[model samples]
Target chain A: MNIKNSNIIVLVSSILLVVGFIISIVNTMVLVSPTEHIEGSWKEISWEYEKTESGNTNKKISDAIKTEICKELIIHEAEVWNFLAGGNLELTSNTNNETLSWTMKGRGNILELSHKTNKIEHYNIQILNNDKMVLYFSTDIQAKGIVKMTFEKIKEDSYAQKI
Target chain B: MLRKFSNSRTLKDNIQLGALSAFSAGMVNVTSLIIFFAFTSNVTGHYAILAEEISKGNWYQASVVFAWIFMFFIGNFISNIIIINFNHKNAYAAHSAPLIIEIICLLAVGYYGHFYYRETLSETEIMVGTMLFAMGIQNGLTASISNFSVKTTHLTGLTTDVGILTAMFTKKKYRQNKQLRSKFNVLLAIAAAYLAGGIVAGVIYYEAKFLVFFAVSAVIGFIILYEYYKLKVTKYIRIKRTIKLRKGILETT
Candidate 1:
């Protein structure tokens, strides 16, 4: 083998090892971004008004209100959002099946989804982890209010829990 | 823009190189941001994101960011390697090789996004990584060949340099310094070109989509061909002068 080639190979390998080692060590210490945790299958848990002129309420949102809020949005009340690798998000609901593309903006704090119809929507990622995510989006569909949407990561293909 | 190599390159050469390369760099960063929600020209943000991922114990995300940064590193490594190894063999080839590779990378991303992009997370990661690598190669070649006097891919350093020079120009003595003025001009050209490129790209991206990549590649391709044409014309002129000198000497004899 050529000395120059071997030397270069060794250098490259050393750098790669160093990078991998640092990341693995940091992984144990653990601080993941929203983009990574946003992936995989998430079942919609709820849709509620996060902010209102009256006051915050823990009461359940009516089915009529849910439908109204989802009217302008592509996703329905009880869809299973399967966020796969490479920005493809497959949304499956009882009456609808939709495919959309997603990207993280504002340093992974915002999730931007682009539909096949060229409609774009942005949601603020409130909280994201291994199994749960909370998204907040403002809707002017009815009046003006902040809508909070919750999702739980599904372990299997089953959607036992949905909105 | 690419006809000369280290030490011999003039301020004019650096300015031309800086402006054109920075323009492409701007287009690339904006396009990547639009398509992938990423800034490909610089690694500072990626480093932060990598740390954020690692700190969260998200091995998958951490690995992805790490790999992205590594691609950038590898691009720089490969670019410099080509320059060092081939500079003696042929300076133009050495310098131009990295750019050709960059063009190929840009075109690949463009073609893939245009025709086959299903918009998957993995695709975004890979495309952004490839772009970072391409930008890395560009930054490396420009810096190396220009003897580090010109770097056009990122603005942190350029901005800092511009700020310092602007402050220095406050002094009439420094304002009269030719070298300082030339350096300032080059830096300004890079900054302006980068901004203009980003604006043009952002506007056209809405209309062109992935075709913007093809346009960026065309700009880069023009640089190479322009230099090649200049080299040929210079060679022809030199050959003619040598022939004329020989004929004059024979007539005198």
Candidate 2:
């Protein structure tokens, strides 16, 4: 090998490596920024239902204490959601809001919020909710993989106001 | 006349043949990648991609990938049959058959791709399959001549070999020094040239896709003519000198 020629190859190789690394970094940063920096929190509710196998009665039935259970479930859910919201919610001032929809792919997320005739799009919102308080959140995932999530709704706070 | 026909001729013949084959491989790789978004030169990367796609349940993309693979196999099969029947060891005649096949395929691409079947089949499928076959034939025919040492199709193995050889050169334990250096240099040249060719191919294909194949055909033609001329001239000069010496001997006698 000619030392000079080999040196040139080495130089080219280093340049290619650096360029590749930089591209990878930029791509990652661009992809991660919106998803990581979304300025919203999810207010959600959780309900747990179970099946029981009994010898005498192998049928579905809501427990006799179902109302209390439901109330506790709702209250627990509200507290958790309120804790998650960190005081960033309005309960008294009701205003018409539109439902937003979005999809997350690879490193990036695309969000679409539709209200009236005008729809606004957000980048990288981890969670969203409609007026009915249904929560929609996204997580970073592979080309295709199981994305883990938790959803719930919080109790109303009288003093809370929308920012 | 007889003395001129010796083993050294074999070395020169193989080098010229190998370089041409390598160039053909490069052209095939470039053209295939540009047209099909697939690589026919080496199936290793393709296989990896296929596996990943399959795992992700990407059946459509996997099918497209396999189309290229099948085309490459077709190219290899066709080239092998042609070479086996005609005895492609002869320099000029050996390259001509494959060159004709490659040109015919390109014309087919222009015809089928442009007007006749453009709407019939997906562009991606046609381009991938056809380019695969082109690279296959190009690789198969030239690979036959080069004893497969010089591959133009891809540089992964070449890069690996170069790395190994370079590392070996640094170690002080090698017994065969001079021979090692020559072999290493040859590997280095093959790899470096392959990368350079890839970069050039990328640039050229952006401007003119068909020119890539035409340029390759020209290069291979040039190599064949070069070897033919060099061998004929050397033989002719040797014969003339031999005749002159015989005449001188007769005069002296």
Candidate 3:
């Protein structure tokens, strides 16, 4: 290819890349909100604790209290959290069911889930996409650590429903 | 290898450039994956993630992915800029500039990750971005200096080329084509070297962790030093031959 044509190709690709980047930023700022994206049924896939102690770190849920909490909150069969519209979150599992108030704070990075007994828990939104959400929160029960929970959105097959 | 102008480069030069750069790229990619859970040497998966994030309205993630892509693009742009602007004056300096930059980036990552990195999300993002930029420089330099014959940072295109060449070789005429065979060899060498580098990196990372970046830098450094050594050796041979001819003329006089 001629130099001029090659330059044009590079210019066009660069422009497209810059334009796409700007559009992504603008879209994030104006078109979508965390609350809107978080409103769905999601199943718990996995959870782990990132434990940091004296400059050494390991990611595992080893503390007894943390393990018990995981069992109570996540390990049951068919554990799912359904974030509904109008600021309500419904958590369901084989042994328990509860409804809570959910709100996104800190520009959609902090997810606040308020329980019925007025206990409020905050999870940092590590990742929140359409199909997956990863939430994390620090704990000091056993050691200075962070707990990360990964959830996958449970997609209901509308076509299969019709069938 | 020091000859910056693509047409002057030999097949051996192309092989050395392709194999070393591809190996370092592979090491960088795998090491980044192990540390940051992100691919650094290639943007194909990042592009897909960008599209996915945009489609899903995860604008934050979309922007992050876009920024990563932009860094890679900027690295390529900077590398080519250095080459096209200075290649006329000093081919070796111009070509080595990008690899030097890549080495610095890798070393910085290695140092910061080993001593200071806290495994935070921000740290991961920045480290991954730095790696992508370094790989971009490498990819740009190899492709530019080889007349676009060798691109080492990503194997998707190289793999496609190899596949096409292999299929073409089924024809008797294509089998006899020297250029096609040479191209196939370069691609295969690059692919094999990339895989081998990744395997070595994986094992090193298991024992040494972030110091794997140092090993990658050493590989790139070797490429530069090897070329310089060859240049010096050839100059010495020519000088020796000229001196011997002068001695012969003196005796004849």
**Which candidate wins on DockQ?**
1
RMSD each, Å = 6.2, 19.5, 11.9
Misplaced by over 4 Å in model 2 are A1-163, B1-15, B18-20, B56-60, B88-91, B107-121, B173-176, B245-249
Residue B228, candidate 1: Cα error in Å is: 0.4
How close is every model to the real structure, measured as TM-score?
Answer: 0.78, 0.51, 0.69
- Native contacts kept (model 1): 0.10
In the order shown, the candidates' DockQ scores are 0.19, 0.02, 0.13
lDDT of 2 at A131: 24
Where does candidate 3 stray beyond 4 Å?
A1-163
Report, for all candidates in order, the number of backbone clashes: 18, 6, 0
Clashing pairs in 3: none
C-alpha displacement of B30 in model 2, angstroms?
Answer: 3.7
Clashes of 3: 0
- Model 2 chain A weakest 10-residue run by lDDT: A139-148
Q: iRMSD per model?
A: 5.1, 14.5, 7.2
Give the candidates in order of lDDT, highest first: 1, 3, 2
What value does DockQ give for candidate 2? 0.02
Candidate 2 residue-wise lDDT, B138-202, digit = tens: 76765565555545565777778777878887777653586566556556555555565566667
